[model samples]
Target: MIESWRWYGPFDKITLPEIAQTGATGIVTALHEIPYGEVWPSALVASRNGEIRAAGFDWVVVESLPIHERIKRGEGDLSELFANYRQSMANLAANGVKTICYNFMPLLDWTRTDLTAPVARGGSCLRFEAAKMAAFEIHMLGRAEAEADYTPEALQMAAIWFQKASETDRDALLHAIMSGLPGAFDRYDIAGLRQALKGYEGIGRADLRANYQRFLDEVVPAAEDLGMALCVHPDDPPRDILGLPRIVSSGADITWVLNAVDSPANGLTFCTGSLGANPTNDLPALARQFADRVHFAHLRNVRKDPDGSFEEAAHLEGDTDMAAVIAALLDEQKRTGRIIPFRPDHGHELLWDAEKGTHPGYPLIGRLRGLAELRGVIAGLRHRD
Candidate 1:
């Protein structure tokens, strides 16, 4: 596995020089400045690649080249959006960046109820509490059909949570969930969220799956031709939320997605943190089963609760058997002699991380610690061989 770090382009609080000192040679990033559904010109792609190279690191993967909502919803004529996406892939390939990681989660990218849930270790980690999420959807967002999505027990819990939550708590929950949308701070509100949810009114699991297949049919071939791999990231939390369908959240779903467009370019971004949120995922087994099709990996772990609450755990300490997963990936690399680029994802905010005020789950020291721990695991595993 090639070690990589996700950098949110020029504006990221963690600079390239600081990243270079982390011992990672590969950079996983995207041209976040460009709006979704826009073509990334070859020159701009080349410039970004040059910027990484100048910092003594290789841009190994495009963390995402976002899919337009129109494309995801299978809405009206998306020929232009499809064209833009293909062009972006071509541009990225032209600049020698071949692996692309993206997700098809509706409305929100990755939902969490708390961005700074304190842990026993005195550090903070991202968390998702089921009742709180239910509270937000039921009492806060006031989605009419939200109650139908939860069980009677869950509804009661949510009601209690909503009743007990103060104005500040409610506001924080709203911010945490809404902030998952890109540029949400500027445009997101209760009305905006309701409007967004309205778009998916008639769409369900099958509809979203069909839309994803349509997207693959359109762009996978282009990616293959460009010698690129388009890897779809697993839905964060790996479950239904906001009454929206999450198609890419399990082994069966991943198998269906890979089979939709049978090509090396049509692949999976094996995200442990996301997949591990679901207790039944069996991370090591899934890693072994999908090893050949995995183009990138988000190596992190999570502590899951029976009630669907979860928090980002230390890279190696959660329910996921990190060593076993890494071992499977290592075996795949050995079998095919192909390198899988992976990054330590969603690290806890520790040391000076809280003070730096970096993006949630993206503090410098926290990720550095995760990387070091993961690197040590890899080394120890290899030493046994």
Candidate 2:
């Protein structure tokens, strides 16, 4: 495994020099400033890659080339956007970059109810609390049909939770889901968000799945031609949330998706955190099954419930069997002779990190702990050879 870290580009509080100190050798990043659907020019790709290399890191993977709303809806300018995405793939390939990771979740990228849940580490971690989400949907965003999505008992519980929330709590809730927050696919005000959803109003899971198939058919060929890997990231919270459709949440979902295009260029991101958000997803098992197609990985564990509540657990201790997952990944690497780019995903906010303003759970020491633990696991597995 090639150790890497996700950097949100230049403005990120964690600098490349800081990342170097963590002993990471690669950077997982994308051009966030370039809005969705715009072609990433060869110059921009080269420039970004150059900067990372200059900072003593290999530009190993593109965390995403976001699938535009237009493409998802198959609506206005979608064909043009699809072509642009193809062009972006070619540009990245032109700069000798491969392993592009993207996701297909609707209206949101990834979501969590709390970015600062208390954890044992004397700091905080990002958490996805189902009740808090219900709290947001029903009492906060006031979604029209939100009350229907949950059980009557759940709503009753949420009403009590809502009663304790003050104006500050509401603002935090709004910010947690919006304001360029980590889990949300993208941030928009209530009105703008509704408008975004309006665009996908008629599009359901079937339409989205069909669109994904159509997209892979069109873009995977481009990727293969350009010698690039197209890695599709799994849905975060991996199930239906806020009444939106979720297509990439299970093994069957992955199998169906891979079969949709049936090309080596089409691949998976292997995000354990996203998949582990659901207790049912067997990470180690899936690793072997999808080994060859996994282009990048986000390895983190979650403490989850069937009710959809989950908190980030210590890298080595959550519901995910990290040791087994690591072993499977290493075995696959040895068999395939491919170095997979793996990152620790979200680290809990702790120690010196809590005092400083940094992206939540991106603290260096915590991730260093995660990376070292994972490295030890790999070493143990390799030594058993």
Candidate 3:
């Protein structure tokens, strides 16, 4: 595995020089300044790649090249969106960046109920609690039929949780969940959110699966022709949220998507933190099963509770068998003789980053610690492999 770090382009708080010092030789980033469904002019792609090389780093992967909502829902002007997405892929490939990571989660990206859940080590990590999420969807967002998804006990717990939360707390949670999209901020008002949810009111899991299949059918060939690999990121928290259907949450989902196109260009971004959120997912086994198709990796862990609450645990300290997962990856590398570029997916805000403000789960020192831990794991396991 080639060590990489996700840098949010020039606007990120952590500078390239600082990232270069972290012992990562590759960068996972995107042209975030360009809006969704817009052409990424080759000139801009070249310029960004040049910047990364100038900073002594290689552009390993585009952590995301946003998939337009129109494309996801198979609505609006999909032809235009697909053209733009394909052009972006070609431009990225032309610039020598091949691997691309994207997701199809409706309306929101990866979400969490708390951005600063305290860890035993006196640091903070991101958390997603089902009860708290239900509280937000029911009492706060007032989404129709939101209570139908939770159990009776969970519903009662949500009522109590919502009752105890103050307005300030509610706002904080809302901001944490609603904001943080690449190149976007806390501009998602209630009306806008509700309106967005309305678009998916009748769409269920089956419909989402079909749409995603169509997405693969339309884009995978272009990716293959361009000699670029497209990796679809798993749903964060790996479950349904906001009354929206989630399709890419399990091994079945992965198998479905990969079979849809049946090409190496159509691949998976094996994200442990996302897939590990669901306790049923066997990380190492899945890693091995999908080894041939995994183009990129996000190595992190989450401590999951039976009730669907989870917190981002330290890289090697969580429920995931980091050693087994890494060993599987190393085995795949050895078998195929292909390098998989992976990064410390998300980290707790620890050390110097604990004292300062930074992107949630993206604090510098926290990720540095994660990388170091992962490096040690790889070194120890690679020898045995």
Candidate 4:
């Protein structure tokens, strides 16, 4: 496996030089400045690659080249959007960045109800509490159909939570959920959110899945022709939220997606933290089953509660059997002779990270500790072999 780190371009407080010092030779990043639906020019791609190389790292993977909202919803001017996406892939491939990770989640990206949930040992981790999310959706967002999505017991819990929540608590919840959108803090208000949801009024699971399949059909061949692999990220919670359907959440969903296109270029970004949120997903078993099609990995873990909430756990401390998953990935690498690039994802905020204003869940020292621990695991496993 190739150890990698995700760097959010030039503005990221953790500079490329700092990333190099973490012992990772591969950098997973994206052209975040490039707006959605715009083509990435070859010169700009080359420039970013040059920057990474100058910092003594290779830009091996694009954490995302975002799929435009119009593309996801099968809205107007799709042909132009598809053309732009293909051009971006070609530009990325021209610059020797062949692996691309993206998601098709509607309206928002990965979400959480608390960005600073305190953990043991004097640190903080990202958390998603079901009740809090339900409260936001039912009481704050006031989505008419939100109640239908939750169990009666869950609805009762949400009602109680919302009834007791102060103005500050409600505001924080809104911020946490909205923070998942790219630049949404400044760009989106409740009206914007409602309008976004309105666009999907008639769309359901089947409609969204068809739209995703259309996207795959159009782009998978282009990716193959460009010598690139396109990996779709799993939904963050592996479940529907805000009444929007999540098609890439379970093993069955993964199977449906891979079968939808049936091409090597179409692949999965195996995200442990996302899939592991669902108790039924056997991480090690799924890793083994999909090893051949897993083009990238997000190596993180989460602790699930009985009440359907979850928190990011230490890389190796959660329900996931990290050693077993790594062993499977190692075996796959040996079998296929391809090094899988993986990064330590969503590390807790520890030490000076809280003061550094680092991106949520991406603190320096926390991820360094995670990488060191993961490296040790790989070494020990190889010794046993």
- Per-residue error at 86 for model 4, in Å? 0.3
Model 3 lDDT tens row, 1-385? 8999999886678999999899999999988888788999999999999999999999999978888777767786688888888888988998899999999998788898898889996888999888888888899889858888777777889999989999898888888787447665325866788888787868888888888888888899999899999999999868888888888999998998999899999999999999999888999999999999999999999998878889999999999998888888899999999999999977888768965566677899989999999999999887775
Candidate 3 weakest ten by summed lDDT? 178-187
Provide C-alpha RMSD values for all models, in order.
1.3, 1.8, 1.3, 1.4
lDDT per prediction? Answer: 0.89, 0.83, 0.88, 0.89
Candidate order (lDDT): 1, 4, 3, 2
Model 2's alpha-carbon lDDT is 0.83
Give the alpha carbon lDDT tens digit for every residue of 1-385 in model 4: 8999988887588998888899999999888888888899999999999999999999988978888888778887699899999999998998899999999998788899999999888889999988888788888888868887767777888899988989998888887877665521324567788888888888889999989999999999999899899999999888899899999998999999999999989999999999999988999999999999999999999999976789999999999999999999999988989999999999999988899887788899989989998999999998987
lDDT (Cα, 0-100) at 119 in candidate 4:
87
Q: Pairing residues by index, what is the TM-score of model 4? A: 0.97
Indicate the TM-score of model 2.
0.96
lDDT value, candidate 3, whole model: 0.88
Q: Model 3: runs farther than 4 Å from truth?
A: 185-187, 354-356
lDDT of 1 by residue, 144-183 (tens): 6877776777788999988898999888888887655543
Candidate 3 lDDT at 76 equals 67
Model 4 global lDDT (CA atoms, 0 to 1)? 0.89
Which scores better on lDDT, 2 or 3? 3
